[model samples]
Target: MITHIQGRLVEKNPTDVVIDCNGVGYLLNISLHTFSQIPDEESLKLFAYLIVREDSHTLYGFSSVAEREIFKLLISVNGIGASTARTMLSSITPQQVKEAIAHEDVALIQSIKGIGAKTAARVILDLKDKVLKVYDLDENEVSVNKNNTNKDEALSALEVLGFSKKQSERVLDKLLSEQPDANVETLIKDALKKL
Candidate 1:
């Protein structure tokens, strides 16, 4: 298994980035959070998870070890896939997810695009205790109360699709900064480019 990749960030896309390691270029699908932290034309290092299927082999990258751990927990759910787990991280921070699970807030999880009430409940039931134990963070510390959900609702939508909040916010900010009234889908597309 490939534990991590370190090299020049030659290219970046919404769901992936290509890192040039010596003469070889490694393409890694990464979360929006990790995407935002990456700088163009610079050497980068990402903690990684290798997913092998009967038909394909893919590498998923994370900004931190903690985020990678969260991804593992998310994929362990019966119906969750890597894409869904990535979406969950894009919508909510690892800290927010940990807190939501600790408090068993199924509503928060359900709010994400592909997640339903039943799946949301399952996420809380199966991993709440485990996440709490792993992160050593209280529910209050990770609460979603501070976010401006009204302004962030569009971003919340993109995040569910696996674009990080930072990436979403930056793209949205720029779109609005110029047009000042771009619609949801336009903002999403614009933000996708930066991601």
Candidate 2:
């Protein structure tokens, strides 16, 4: 297993990079996230994962170990391939992917270019627990981050009182921005006035 490569950066591109270690040059496939993180310097180091098949060996590199771990987990899914995993990583940040899975946000996952509803659901179903466990994320915390627990509570209250979700969100966003420490009561009150 080519765990990592550290050497002179011989070439850099959006989808791949060539690193020269000693006299050998190694080509590593990479996602756009990794591409952006690659520094414009002579020396480079990248955590790597090697996929060996009967016909060939391919190496994928990541800017951080976290990204690499996420990549490995994604590729472990039944229907997701290395290329698909790379595409998912490139389409969104690793943190976003983790949050989406933890929250079971099928729509967010399906929004990716090549993912379908079934695949998105399968991803959430198969990986939700694993992601939460591996990332040390609590489901409650994930939901809180996704909707901001206080804001969500306020929004729900407003909606029950006949306020539109869009309107409620707008007002709540503004209130939260101005006073981030605002509690649910304050958000609901301010939002009612605005609405």
Candidate 3:
């Protein structure tokens, strides 16, 4: 089991990298997030997950153990494959993936390209509990999930008060990201000031 690779970075691209360990050069598939996280140094280390099929062996690399763990969870779903899991990791940060599942934010999950409504819902359904348990996330922390409700209410109120839904949602997303525990009233107040 090749758990990790530490070697000279022979080549790098948005979707893959080649690392020269000793005299052997190994190519590992990677997500954009991992590609960005990789430092510009000769000596680099990446945690790896190996997928072996009857026809070929593929190696995927992650910048962190957390990202790799999420990839495993994502691929465990009935319809999600390694490529789909990599796409999910590339589309959003690992923390965002965990929060989305824990909070049941189907829209956020569906926002990724190639992910439809059903697949997004399935991701949340299949991994929500596992994510919660593995990450030790209690309601108090994912209170950000609560923010989704509060944020929706705040957006609705703003729309009724003549603000554009698109603009209101943009401002609300920023506000919620900054203050995850803010209530609907607070979100409205802050968003109103910003808008």
Model 2 stretches with alpha carbons more than 4 Å out? 143-195
Error of 3 at 16 (Å): 0.2
Model 3: per-residue Cα lDDT over 30-62, one tens digit each: 999999999999999999999999999999999
The sequence of per-residue lDDT tens digits that candidate 2 reaches over residues 61-87 is 999999999999889888999999999
What's the C-alpha lDDT at position 75 in model 2?
A: 90
Per-prediction CA RMSD (Å)? 11.8, 6.1, 4.9
Cα deviation of 22, candidate 3, in Å: 1.3
Alpha-carbon local distance difference test for all models:
0.79, 0.87, 0.91
TM-score of 2: 0.74
Q: Rate residue 189 of model 1 by lDDT.
A: 71
In the predicted model 3, the residue pairs found to clash are none
Ranking by TM-score: 3, 2, 1
- Clash count, one per candidate: 1, 0, 0
Model 1 spans > 4 angstroms off: 137-195
Whole-model lDDT, model 2: 0.87
Strongest candidate by lDDT: 3
Error of 3 at 79 (Å): 0.8
